[model samples]
Every structure is written in C-alpha cells, then in structure tokens.
Target chain A: MKKKVLTKEDILHLAKLSNLKLSDEEIEKYLKQLEETVEYVKNLDELKTDKVSPTSQTTNLTDVYFADGETNERGLKLKEKYFIVKRIM
Target chain B: MNLHGKSLLELKQLVIEKKISEKELNQYFLKRIRKFNPKLNAFITVLENNQLGIPYGAKDMFCTKGIRTTAASKVLDNFVPPYESTVTKKLQEAGMSVLGKTNMDAWAHGASTETSDYGVSKNPWDNKRYPGGSSGGSAAAISAYLVPAAIGTDTGGSIRHPSAWCGVIGLKPTYGRVSRYGVIAMGSSWDCPGPMTLNVEDNAYLLKQIAGKDKYDATSSSIAVQDYTNEIKKNKKFKIGIAESYFAGIDDQIKKHVYKSIDVLKKLGHAVKPIKLLPPKYSISVYTILQRAEVSSNLGRYDGIRYGNDRNFFGQEAKRRIMLGTYTLSYGYYDAFYKNAQKVRSIIIENFKSVFKDVDLIVGPNTPVTALNIGEFEKYPFYGELMDQLNEPASTAGIPDLSIPVGLDSNNLPIGFQIMGNYFEEANILNLAYQFEKETDFFGVIKKGINNYKD
Candidate 1:
C-alpha cells in the first residue's frame, strides 16, 4: 500500500477546515505527525473489507432532540448564540 | 481494616453496623488526599466536605454541578458545570460522595497522563513512573488509598490501561451499559465510564450503583441492570479463550505472568483453549480514525461560545488529532480512510463475536508493558498509542473488559490481563474475575501498601 503522505499545503488546508490557526513551526511539526498518523491508518487497506458493512454506532439511536425551553443550564451565552468570530462575516 | 483500606462492600457494611460515621469516613479520606495528592498529583481539585458512603474520586471528565470539570485541560480550567452527569447523580443517590475531580490527559487524548495540562499523576507504586492515563489520577488515587474507588472514562483503554499499571481493578463496562450524560466526549461511540477500585467486589459494587438507562442519554442501554455483587459471588467455571496473536510482541515477563494466570484458572477446573482472534493492529488503525474523527466533531462545541476559553486552549495533542480528523473526513479521503476504518471495525466485532461462540470470555495482557518512567513520553513520542495495542480491539468492539492485577514484574510494578465478555455480559466478566481474586493473593498484595490497615 502506498503510504499517505500529507504535504504542507494539505496540513494548512486541514487547519482551515478545523478552524485552527497554526504558526510556521507548528505547521512543520504537524505535517510530520499527521503524515505518520495517516501512514499508520493506511494499514486498514490490507484487510478485504469489500463486503463488510460500516458500523457508525454500536447502539440504535436517532433524532435526539431536547425539549424547546431554557432547560439546559449548559447553554450558550447571549453573545455566544450568534458566535462572533474575528474572520467570519 | 482501617476505613481507607476497606472495600466498598466492607465499608458499606461498616456504615450499616454503625462502626464508623459517614462524616468520619469523609474526613479521613479528605485528610489523605490533602496529605498525599501533592506527592501523587492525583487530584486536580479536592473537595473538602463531610458526605457519606464510599467516597470516590471522579475523573474530571464527568461534570459535577458547581464543581470545575476541566478534563485536565486549561481550556476548562475554571469551567464549573451547572448540571451533574447522570452517572455521578446515580452514584450520589446510592450514597457515593465525591472526593474531588481527578486528573487525566487533557481532553482525554493521550494514553499517558503526561498530556494532562494540570500536571502528570505519578504511579503510586513508584513515584518516578507515570500512573497510566487519561484516567491516571483516578487510578493513582485508588492505588494510593486516597479513595477506595474512582470513576473513570475509557475510550481506548483509558480506564483499564492506567489501572493495570497502577495495580488496581478497572472495569470498562459494555458501551451503552452505562450512561454518558454530562461526561466529556472523546469518541462518542467508544467512550465508556467505569470504576477503578482495589478489588473486583468494589468494581462490581460501583457498577451496580451507576449502571442503568436514562432519558437524558439516548445511547444508554435499556437492558436491566443485574445484581452484579450476587453474580460475582457465584463460582461458575468458564471456558476461557487465549489468542496467541494477542500475546505476540508483549514483554516476556508480562507474558509469563499472563500464562501463569491461565494456569491458575485451568487448575480451578475451567477449560482453557487457544483461539484465533482478529488482529489487534487493524483495530488500532480503525480506533485512530474513528476516535480522531469523533474528537474533531465533538470538540467543535468548545469554541469559547458557551463555556471555557477559546479553541487556542487545545493542547498540541488535541490539535494533532483535530487536524488528522479533518483530513480523514475531508472530501477526497472520506472513503479511503474514515469509511474504510468503520468497515474494518465491523470485521473486528464479528471476529470477537465468532470467538465468543466457542468460549465465554477472552483473556490477554491489558497493556504491552508495565508503567513507564515519567519522562519516557519525551523519549518516544508515540509511546501512548503503541502501549494501547492490546486494549484497542475490545474497546473498539465496545465489549466489557476488566483489568485485574495478575502479578508483579522484576521492578515490582504491576502486570495485569484484560478479561473481556460478550456484549452486556459484565456479569460473566465479573464472576470470572471474582473467582480469580479469591484464588490469588494479588489483591491482598496491594493492600500491604496501606499504612494504617489494622489487621
């Protein structure tokens, strides 16, 4: 199996998608770590999983909606509800 | 026995017989935590109160109302929860008091407690070594007799791995068998809250108090909770399966102890057989993918909106996982990485299911090696992940596994095995472990570390 080698650009793109800002040193460090992690995961290709069904969750659960009210004490603050971000317009 | 050295059952009996007051028991442990926590670094927050009945150290991952639940991360360093987790609330109802929030790997991301932002928890047996984590604080506290037992969350060997290294009993119950409400989420499908204790009876006693369904958690199982204490008292011999492939690459000293444990079981009249199991290496890959992907998704809520600090509070390990998760779940790599890992997960589950058809339980080493020296993480960057090689399969399969101390190594550090049962069959795991505990002196050996246990 060809190992998955993550490039520098790939790490930057992932950081953007993950809403994280990285320094140049961090990018270099993560590029090496992410590449190694991806290489380790590529071992999955060795197994013949053509016919196996994917297991997203072990239990049967769906549509987990809470009641409409101020019931959750762990809720977001008023300013947090709109989520003011420095970059997001 | 002194109050701190008694098992959960023994202490409960003391409470019943009026031999010791709850306030006295509470003060006794609180004093111990104050005296020993600075040395062990086992507790992130020590609550000094006079509450009753088997005071347990709860891993900071579980939210306690009005108490800071940090998950050992600076992000939530001062984040006090407004609501209590279902498991803790259930335990409180059954008279278990909270000693404090124990330390863990920040965000429960690493195998060693070294990743904890608060500081590392030292092994109770040897202060120079790590206690094993991300539940190291709870395991360390139990090992040091600071708390009789503690609640810990296991995603990929978080509970069992640390407990094994710390020389205690850690039981990771079947996923969904215990509620995850208010507990910090790492891998939604893989995270399970279980007990870390000095003996199997306490493990079973704690499980009975905290295991059940709750409307607050959709994933909580509706299957009735068994009388696990009664179940453990039974003396049924089981057909145990030993997978040679699982034992390969393990330390020779640890392997010798595991084989000796198997010999003891055979002498007790249980039929022991060698069975081929799914390769654990593949589960490691699958676990890496699924856990990171879920972590990326679950951690999205920590954007400094409702709670804690900004996302910048995430440690380097957390950032690494998030980046890996983002890349794997990206448009091009989803099928090749994320989807493929899940399919492999299905295969791993099927492999365990098939093996259980021939035998009631599976046994193997809990960790690849014993407790590591505190600075070993810097020497080997991937130390945590590689150590969990033996535990990933059962964790990914979401089966109940108990880590019990089988014996000690050359350095007197503990070595243990993983006892796994079929889904929702924690009773079988507990029964077998209880019988082993009765026959062996491993549990008693740990008690010798207690300072004031009156014979």
Candidate 2:
C-alpha cells in the first residue's frame, strides 16, 4: 500500500472541513501526527476484504421503528417550538 | 465509621440494616472526595448536597438532568443536561445517587485523561503515573474509594484500560447491550456504557441495573437482560481460549501475572486451550480509522448553535482526530479509508465469531503494559491506539469483555487480566471474573488501592 503523505495544505484543508481553526503550531503538529496516524492505519490494506461487506453497525437490525410523537420538552434552547441559533447570513 | 474498602453491595447492606444512614454514607464519601480530589483530580463536578441514595461517580459522559455533563472538554464545561442518560437514569432508579461527574479525556478521544481540558486524573496507586483513561477518573475514584463504583463508557478501551491501570474491575458490555441515549457520543457504533467497580459482584449488580434495550437508542439490543448477580453464583466450567496473538509484545511481568491467572483458572477445573486469533494490530487500524470517522460525525453536533462552546474550544487531540477523519472521509479517499476500514471491521467480528465456536471465552492481558508515567503519552502520536491494541478487537466485534486486577507489577502498578465473551454474553464474562475474584480476591489489589486513601 502506498502511504499518503499529509502536507500542511492538506492539514489546513482538513481543518477547514472539520470546522476547526488550527493555530500555526497546531497545523504543524497535526501535519506530523495525522501523517503518522494515516500511515499506521494503512496496514489494513494488507487484508483482503474484497468478498466482505462493510458493517456500518453491528446490531444486524434495520428499519427499527418507534411510535411517532413529540414532547414539548427538549434539551435545546428554544423559542416558539424552534431552536434558537446564531444567524449565519 | 470507617467505610473505606467497602464494596457497593456491602454499603447497600449496611444502609438496609440501618448500620449507617444513607445521609451519613453520602457525607462520608463527600468528605473523602473533598479531601482527595485536590490531589487526584478525579472528578470534574462533585455534588456536595446529593443526599438521595448510595453515591457513585458517573463518567462525565453521561447526562444527568440539571447537572453539568462535560466529556472533560471545555466545549461542554457549562452544558447541564436537561434530560438524564438511560444508564444514569437506570442507576438512579436502582437507588444510586450521582456523587459527581468524573473526568475523562476530552470527548473520550484519548486513552489518557491528560487530554482532558479540566486536568489530568492521577493514578490513585502512584500520583506520578497516569490512571489509564478516557475513564481514568472513574477508575481512579473507584480505586481510591472516593466512590464505591462508577459508570464509564468504553469506545475502544476507555473503561478497561483505566480499570487495568487503576486495579478496578471494569466491564465493557456488548455493543447495544446498554442504551447510548443521552451519553455524549464517541465512536457511536462501538460505544458501550458499563460499570467500573472494586469487585466483580458490584460490577454484575450495576450491569444488571443498567443493561437492556431502550426505545430512544435504536441500536440497543432487544435480547432479554440476564440476572447477572445470580448467574455469577452458578457453578459452571468454561472452555477458555488462550490466544497467543493477544500476548504478543505484552510486557514480561504482565505475561507472568496473566499466565498465573490462567493457571488458576486451570486449577478451577476449566479447560484451557491454545487458539489462534487474528493479530490485534489489524484491529488497531480498523479501530483508528472507524473511530476517527465516527468521532468526526458525532462531534458535528457541537456547532455551539444549540449547546456547548464553538468548535474553537476543541482540544488539540480532538482536532487532530477530527482532521484525520475529515481527510479520510473527504472526496476520493472514502473508499480507500473509511469503507475499507469497515470491511476489515467485519473481518474482525467474523474472526471473533469463529474463535468463540471453540471456546466459551477468550482470556488475556488487558493492556500491553501497566500504568505509565503522566507525560509518557506525548512520545507516541497514536499512544492510545497502541495501548488499546488488545482491547480494540472486542470493541470492533461488539462483544462483551471484562478487566480484573490479577496482581500488581514490579513498580506496584496493577496488572489486569481480561475475559472476553460472545455477543450479549456479559453473564459469562462476569461469571468467570466472579469466580476468579472469589479464588484470588484479586490478590488484595483492590484493598491496597483503597488503603492508599484510608482515613
């Protein structure tokens, strides 16, 4: 398996996608750490998984249902049955 | 009025007989917490006025209604949950009071609680050493008798790792055996909320109270919960598998203690057979990729729009995990990383399924080594994953496993022996652990840990 070399730009892009603002030090640190982590995980490539199906969850159950209902109580800060959030626009 | 070294069941018995009032018991633990918390840093939030029932520490991951629940991160430092988690609710209903919300790694991201935004939790045995983590504080608190027991969620090795290091019994029940509702998410597919206690009986007692299905958590199992307390008493011989792969690279002292434990099991008339298991190193990669991916997704909820501080409050470790997750799940890399990891996770699960056909349970050392120095985590980039290599296979396979103190190492740090069972087989895991506890009394490891903080 060819190892992916993680560069500073890749780290910054990932940080952006992850909604994190990394300091210059953090970027440099993650660049090295993330590279090492990525390299380590590539060992999975050694296994032949061609015939196996991915297990997104272990429960082996699908389409589990619950009675549809709504309670007035919620953990979020709410106003008039709507969550209050900072305006993005 | 010395309550030191008393198990949860013993304390309950005392309360029932009116030997000690519940109020006095709560106060006893409260005073201990106040006295030792400054030095140990085990708890993030201590409830001084909690006078409801028998007090136990809850890993800060569980949401307690009207009480602050932080996953040891600054982001949720002020986030008091409006509703209670199912596990805590069940424990509360079973007459357990929340003494405090214990500290953990930030978002349960690291094995060492040094990643905690609040502070690192020290090992009760040696303050210079780390109590193995994400559930480090819970394990530390239980070990030091700050609390009789605690509930900790294990994603990869969060509960068992710390329990091993702190010389306490920690069970990571089968995935979905306990509801995930109201617990802070980390590796959603692998997360299992379980008990950390000073004895196997208390661990079974707590698991009986907390294990079962919940409507709110879709992944929770529909299988009937077993009467684990009674189940532990039944005399049964198990076919235990000794996997050489699990012992590979384990410390020499740890190997000696674990093998001694296996010999004890053999003496108990249980058959021990050598079995081949897939090298645990493969599960490490599967766990790292899949867990990081799940973490990135689970943490997406913390936009600061509804609860917790903004993404800016994420710790360095959390950021690093999120970035790697994003990189893997990003365009063009999903197939090479995320999807492939899932396929390998399937292989690991199948591997355990096949091994269980020949054995009732698999036993081995819990961690590769004993408790490490506080600052040793910085030496490795993926220190938690490496430390948790043996534990990840069970986590990935969604099986039940327990960690019990076998003996102390040369440094006086605790060595842990693990017994892993088939899916939803917590009863079997607890039974073997209970039998071992009766035979060896865990070599007085738990007693020594509590005596370290004797009043």
Candidate 3:
C-alpha cells in the first residue's frame, strides 16, 4: 500500500468538513502532525484483513431495544412541546 | 481526628463506628483539596458543600446532574449536565458523594493532562512531572489522598496509564462491563468507565458498584456482576502469562519492576509462563484510526446552539484529531482507513481470545516509561499512543486489565505492572491483584505516595 501524502489543501478540505476554523499557524501545524499520524497508521496494511469482518461493537448483542413509552427530558429550553432556537433569516 | 493515609474501607469503617462523622470526613478531604489542589491542578471544580456521604473525585468526563462537566475542554467550560451518568448515580447510591470534577485531557484526547484546558495535573509523587492521563487528575487526586477513590473512563489506557504513573490502582474493565450512558464519548466502541483507587480492594469495591447492565447504554453487558470485593478473597491461583513483546522497547527500570512483580506472584503459588501475543505496535494503529473516527462523530453534536462553545474553542489536539477523522471518513477514504482499522480490531480481539485459551491472565509493564516531565509531549507527534503501547492491545481487544503499583523507578517515580484478563473476567484480575497486594503491599508505593502530602 502506498502512503497517503496529506497536503495543505487536504487540511483545508478536512477543516471545512469538520466544521472547524483553523488559523494559518494551526493549518501548518496540522499539516505536519496529521501527516505523521497518517504515516504511522500505515502499519495496519501489514495485516491481511481481507477475509475478516469489521467489528463495530465488542458485545455480542443484537436487537437491543429500549422499552416503549419511556421518555426522559433533555433539559433543553422548551415551550409548549416546541424547542426554542435562535432565529435565522 | 486525622483521616490521612486511610483507605476507603477504613474511612467507611470509621463512619460506621462513629469515630468520624461522614460530614467531618468530607470536610477533612475538602481541607486537603484546598491545600493540595492548587499545586497539583488535579481538580477543575471542587464541591465544598453537600457533605452527607463518603466523598470521591470524579473524572470530569463523567456527567454529573446539575454539576459542571468540562471534560477539561474549553468548549464545554460552562456546560452543566442535566442528568447524571450511570457510573456517578451508582456510586452515589453506594454511599459516595462527588467531591469534585477532576481534570483530564480535553475530550479525553491525550495521555498527559497537559492538554487539559484547566491546566496540567502534576504528579503527586513528583510535582515536576505529569500524572499520566487523560485520567491524570483522577489518578493524582487518589495518589495525594485528595479523594479516597475516583471514577475514570478509559478508551485506550486513559485509566491504567495514569494509575501506573500515579502509583495507584486503576482497572479498565472489559468493554460493556460498565455503563457509558453519560460519559463524553471518545471511542464509542472502546469507551469503558472503571475505578481508580488507592488500593486493590477499593478498586474491586468500586467496580462492584458501577459494573452492570444499564437500560441507558445499549452496549452495556447483561453479564452477572460479581461481588468483586468478596471474590478477591478467594485466593485463587492463576496461570499468568508474560508477553515479551510487551517488554520490547520498555524502559529498563519498568521492566525490572514488572519482572520482580512476576517473581512475587510466583512466590504466592501462581504459575508464570512465557506467551507470544500480537505486538502492541499494531494496536496503536488500529486505536488511532478508530478512535479518531469516533471522536469526530461524537464531537459533531456540540454545536454552540445545542451546548458548549463554538467549534473555534476546540483546542489544537482536538482539532487535529477531528480533522484526521474527517479526512479518513471522507467519501473516498472510509473503506481504506476506518473500515480497515475495524477489521484489524477484530483480528486483535481474536489474538487475545486465542492467547487466553492457555493462560488465565497476562502481566507486563503498563507504560513504556514512568511519568515524564511537564512539556515533554511536544517531542513526539503521537505521544499518547507511544506511551500506551503496552495498554492498547487489551483495550483494542475489549478485555479487562488492571494496573497496580509495582515499584518506583530510580527517579523515585512509580512503575506500574498491569494484569490483562479474558473478556468479563474482572473477578480473576482483581483476585490476582488482591493476592499480590496482600503479599507485597504494592512495595509500600501507595503509602509512600500519601506520605508526601502529609497534613
């Protein structure tokens, strides 16, 4: 597997996707750090996981369901069954 | 009456015998917190009032109803949880009160609490060094006797690493053993809430209170919770395995202390055998990718509209992780990074399952080295993963593991020896640790830690 080389543009794209606003200094810092992390994680390629299935959760549980008609307050501001939010144009 | 150097059980006994009222005991710890917390920065918030039950520190990651849960991040500095975490509720019902919200790495992202927005938690053993973290504050508070015990959640070595560095007992219970309903999610698949205490018995006792299925957390197991405090007294002999791969690249002093602990286990009639397991380096890769992916997903809910400060308040470490996760989970890259890491996680789980078929438990040095000095994380790009190399395997496998103080390094820092057990076998893990504690008293490491903070 070839290593994925991250670039400044890639950092910007990721920052936009993650809803984060990074300064010029942070972009430069992350370019180097994220590249290092991505490179380090490349070691996983050494294992052949083609035949194996991905484990989403460890407990061998299926169809875990909460009992019906159970409700708890979220503690957010509410008025007459409607949540209040900032007005947007 | 002086309550210094007393164990949780001792304090409970005092209250039962009327030697000290619970209110007085809480005041005693509050006085100590006022004195030591300034220097150690172990707590982000201290509850000076409401002294009705036995007091203990809670890692800031666990949400307490009507109390601030910062998670050591500026983003959530003012965010108070409206409902209680199952762990804290269980502890409170078990006659424990929350003393304070202890500091942690922001969003539980780093190994050292240096990343905490509230400031770093200094090691109780050496003020100049870090208390290994993101559970650093919990470990430090227990080490300094600021609180009798603390509850910390471990995604990957957050509890054991700090416990090792702070010379305390920390157990990372098998995934799904403890409810994670209100814990600020880091790695949802890997997050485990467990106990950090001054002694093995306290660790067992706390686990008994918090370990069980919860209707709130779907992943929590339905396995029967054992009376761990009683189970440890059985004095069962375990077949312990020492993996050489865990020792590779470890500090010489830590290796020596772990071997010495193995010798003590041997003296106590437990069998020790050499076993081959997957190298820890592989788990580091799997942990980093999967954890980052989870962090990105979890943090997405924290828009300023819902709660917490805006995204701009995220620290450098959290931003770096979130960006990496976004990149990996992007349209084209998900199969390569996120899915592959999960596959590797399954492989690691199978590796542990196979090894446990022959041995009852695995023991080794918990951290590669003792607690490092403050400001040392800058040298390594992936400092937490490297610091937690020996710990990530059990975490990745979702098995229970415990770290107990073995001895101190030449610098007078604590070294931790960890025992890894098969899935849902905390009783067995606590049994061996209890036996060793009875035989060696953790080399007086826990006692010496409290002696440094004499009132």
The prediction achieving the highest DockQ against the true structure is 3
Q: What lDDT would each prediction earn against the true structure?
A: 0.87, 0.91, 0.91
The CAPRI-style docking tier of model 1 reads: medium
Per DockQ, what order, best first? Answer: 3, 2, 1
Interface RMSDs of the predictions, in order, are 2.2, 1.4, 1.0
TM per candidate: 0.93, 0.96, 0.96
Total backbone clashes of candidate 1, pairs 3 or more residues apart or in separate chains? 0
lDDT of 2 by residue, B363-443 (tens): 999999898899998785586679998899999999999999999988999999899999988899999988998999999
TM-score of 2: 0.96
Candidate 1 per-residue lDDT, tens place, B165-214, comes to 98889999999999999999999999999998888888898899899876
Give lDDT tens digits, candidate 3, residues B1-455.
Answer: 77898899899999999999989999999999999999999999999895889999999999999999999998999999978999999988988899999999999998999889889999999999999988999999999999999999999999999999999999999999999999999999999999999988888999999999888889999999999999999959889898888888889998888888898999999899999998999999999998899999999987888788999899988988899989889998899999999999999989888889999999999999899989888886586679988889988999999999999999999999999999999999999999998999999999999999998
Which CAPRI category fits model 2? medium
Worst 10 residues of 3 chain B by lDDT: B376-385
Across residues A1-89, which tens digit of lDDT does each residue of candidate 1 receive? 86548778898899998999898999999988887777777789899999999998775456665557725444443474595345655
Candidate 1 segments whose C-alpha is farther than 4 A from its true place: A1-4, A60-89, B381-383, B451-455
Clashing residue pairs in candidate 3 (N, C-alpha, C atoms within 3 angstroms) = none
Model 3: CAPRI class: medium
